[model samples]
Target: MPKLNLSQSPAVRAKWEENLKLDSQEKVTSSQQQLPNSAALTPQCIEKRWQVIAERTNKAALLDTDSEKQQNLYSSNIEHFIGTVKLPVGLAGPLLVNGAHAKGEYLVPLATTEAALVASYSRGAKLITEAGGVTALVINEGVTRTPVFEFANVTKAGEFVAWAVTEYEQFKQLAHSTTRYGKLKDININVEGNRVYLVFEYLTGDASGQNMVTFATNTIYQYIIQSCPVDIHSCYLDGNLSGDKKPNSHTMRSVRGKKVVADITIPAALIEKRLHTQVAKMVEFGQMTTTGSLLSGGIGVNAHYANALAALYIACGQDPACVAESSIGITRMEQNAQGDLYASVTLPNLMVGTVGGGTHLPSQKACLDILGLYGSGNARALAEVTAGLCLAGELSIVGAFCAGHFSRAHQRLARR
Candidate 1:
């Protein structure tokens, strides 16, 4: 292919000249028409730009600001902020959680636009609450960050892996040195030819430690570069081995954020009265769905965990994107001898925290406060509630499907 001279093209000449002037630090003549002023598109600048455009377009209320309450919120959290995009946040519960830490009737704030979502969850919450609430257990807690290193050959990569295992204490010390709240818990080694992925798992206290583990891993990476026994050809921060914000089989088996199991046993009579479905039907539905999920080679077998996770995460100031992985889990429904329904959800990766990220935002914090999950020390409680809420949602949605009321309910509520 021949290279075309962009300088000869009038369309490209102006941009090329501007780039050359920028590179050479040459001042353009004042007679030259300057580019529109866009120095750091702050909220003020964005508002001004919108106003100018509105004047030309006869558009009213297009650039209005309802963020008089947000003047103090835009420091480092965001840039180019005009106003907050409002989602219709609805209160769903009085969800009674019988967990190790979270034991109470707490109102769940759910931010969603989907009609009947909150109503469905609320119906489930009522069933659980009346049935003495859902029991939630936090089985494990650890956040992981993986960094990949390349060696000359497989032999060197294997050697590096062995060295990493031996120098675990040193790596832990280096990782822990970066943050006061984060502690290095475990290191997993994965080898592929001349490449090695060092999966660093950490206990990030009170905060969902994506950023925490990243910074800690950077320190460990520096240490590995300085002290590795083998010569490394290249090193990259994440090799997608940590499975951050993506579905992975390992995250489903092992702990990612807070491995939580929530369960509730509803009597046959109550299932008939509340869910309008028999225990046997719900159990059969579970079996069919689970088999279908297994046949599809899915990571977890569940009905719409993302619906609950996303709504709750957004309402409660969590890393909403983490729902991608956090929603991966199993929902089991079994029929007992007495015809009672034993339903449980195992959320192996419920990535949540009470601090950091958008948890401090005004609306998000208010929502967290509604669950009593604001600030520090309530991360475990938050995890438990999150898991319990998920179970409630699954039960409701699955029951809706089983009872053949899913479409009817949507048609009735969603249309309005």
Candidate 2:
């Protein structure tokens, strides 16, 4: 098979070059006034930024009445501090989770404006609870940052890789020196022509660890530049190989933040009575969706993983952007010996944290408290609960589709 190359066409090339020229011109001519900038986490700085926004936009709605509390607590999490945006937090559970870390029923808080979302997840949660709950486990865990070093030629790259392998201990030491919670796990090296990418994987305790791994990688990079026997022409902190905040096949195969799997077996009688569909119909629908997923060239095969993850992450103060990679997973449905339905969801990159980021924020913290998953010892439990939540969402959505009520439910809830 031959790959289609659109850039090879003269017309396409000319259009692309023209677009680039216009973009460059726009960058030079744009007179967008920069907002007030500051590193200081004071109420004055926050007020200044908010004033500028209101003056320019002519909208003076206050974010909150208490500016001091916002400045004190939210400074570390955000910059250009202008109040906060609110989303409706909906409850979707009695989601019974039986897992290595997470146990018991949780009333999962989901923040979303999508009309039928909470209802769908709630319906699935109730069904799962009736079926004796879902089993969830955190199978693997790691956070990675890839640093690329460019040399003059392949030989120099090979020499750098050879020297780099021996410095794993020193690299570990330097990385560990930066953080008490993160530990250097392993370093994998990949060579491409004159460039070598050093993949540093770390075990970050209780946090998503994007910043943790970056700081650790920087420490290692600095040490390498000063101590390496081989010379490097150029280098970058991130080579875009770690699959951070992006959906890729690598994360689908291996783990990134936390790999969690959740499954449940529901009786056929319950499926028919509660879900308004038979086990056979659900399995058939699953097969059709799997084929459709393949045709679309999606990274993982699943139904609406993003819907659940996005809502949960937002409500819990996780980096919502992580959903790009975090939602990539495979969902399977099959029939057991008794013709009961067995459903499972495997999320290989569940980037989540129990502390840090937005977890400490008022509403987010309250949501975490609702699940009893706040503070340090609950990250893995949170991941397990998330997997179980996703399983509930998948079953609900698949059941809705199979029962031919998907559009009707959306119409009833979303439209009216």
TM-score for each of the candidates: 0.88, 0.91
The model with the greatest lDDT is 2
Give the range of the ten consecutive residues with the poorest summed lDDT in model 1. Answer: 27-36
lDDT of 1 by residue, 1-416 (tens): 23347648786776676777675554445423232376443556666655545545533333334464454564556554444567899887779999998999988999999999999998888889999999999999999988999999998888888888998998888887899999999888889999999888999999998999999999888888898878999999899888899988897778899999999888999999998988899988989988899899898888988998999898877888999899899999998787799999999998899999889988899999888889889999999998888888988998899999999999999997
Q: Which pairs, if any, clash in model 1? A: none
Please state every model's RMSD to the true fold in angstroms: 5.3, 7.2
Q: Compose the digit string of candidate 2's lDDT tens values, residues 171-262.
A: 99999999989999988999999999999999999998999999999999998888888888999999999999999989777899999999
Clashing pairs in 2: none
lDDT, model 2, position 42: 74
After superposition on all CA atoms, how large is the RMSD of candidate 1? 5.3
